[model samples]
Target: MRNLTQTVTRWAPTGTDAAGDPIGYTRTEILGRWEESQQLFTRSDGTEAVSRAIVYLASDVAVGDFLLQGSSVSASPPSTAWRVEAFRKVENLRGTDSERRAML
Candidate 1:
């Protein structure tokens, strides 16, 4: 059997705007998977944008376990929410025997 591990990190905006209006955003990063690879998507200022998403996998992350941050936007809330528009695979590490071996 093959042992597979995956981790995702996401961010979103949750706070009041300049006029004290509620707003939010979202983003996600996935590792050790084929369909969803290393990529980060985000929406800021009510606009959507895509950028290179980088991630590192360690033994600390387990399935169904997620780390989240949240706070007030006006006061530079330590926890901000971002909106996720889309995701694409920029790099994949799982392939044939030789490719897998090279990764190790």
Candidate 2:
């Protein structure tokens, strides 16, 4: 296991309302290794996105959802919410699943 130093708050997607506004979110706290990096990844829509941070955890994260700094996750999320652009399961050199990675 990695030495996870940060707590990341995830806002799981709940379907929007008829008005196109977000109805609600299922929030979860993830303890993970957070790193600030510049990386390119493909979105679900086949578009390229530059990720500002990468989070490694043992839990699964959904693409199209939102992530926030744990300290900044309050009643209302911060304006700089990072939308989950991609997700990948990392494997170790032994060909075993290691961790879940989220590109934000």
Candidate 3:
């Protein structure tokens, strides 16, 4: 039921600074099914988080990645960024990887 296209931005560690701090991120455009939902889930860090939206896609996205509402590719990022709180891969009935679901 993929019906939406959004932008997924992830932090890409190009290199470390003088203090050994990671920096920089590049935006990625991905088409997925976006749905507004109210679900509670446990994060990978064992923290409780409430998801306001969910996105289903074929590509994988990390927990901290950002998800834009629409297919927006601009020089400057959008102000309304939804941070991914949880992510998991779903399998088909045949046990093959079908899609990845992200909670934001």
Candidate 4:
């Protein structure tokens, strides 16, 4: 679709075959919007904590496997890596293939 939020790029970490063979780098394409959220909370010790997460639409290809937090998605060059904290399934997005939420 023409109105996709951003181009999600996946960089697969090296994999090993059953015979102990090496699998080269693999790149895949996923489309979604990467957003940053912050929440402030007070602890019992009166300490403040800011929770940050990069939220995005889950990828149909990854299926939440072989995905690490250090990887990231970018619309252009100079990307930033985000940690994968949690994932939740959300309403089906328009013009998208998956209906899940990813907390990076």
Candidate lDDT scores, in order, read 0.32, 0.79, 0.71, 0.48
Residue range 57-88, candidate 1, lDDT tens digits: 32223211222222232322233322233322
lDDT (10s digit) by residue, model 3, range 1-104: 34545545443345557987545556667768778998898899899988898888758887666777666565434567677889998778988557789898
Which lDDT tens digits does candidate 2 get at residues 36-62?
898998887899989899888768888
Q: Per-residue alpha-carbon lDDT of model 4 for 1-104, expressed as tens digits?
A: 23446766655436667986535545555666665677554433566655465545545433222232333453222235443344555554475455555554
TM-score, predicted candidate 1 vs. hidden true structure: 0.21
The residue pairs found clashing in candidate 3 are none
Better of 3 and 4 by TM-score: 3
Between candidates 3 and 4, the lDDT winner: 3
Clashing pairs in 2: none
Best by lDDT: 2
Q: What is the C-alpha RMSD of each candidate to the true structure, in Å?
A: 11.8, 2.3, 3.2, 8.9
Candidate order, TM-score descending:
2, 3, 4, 1
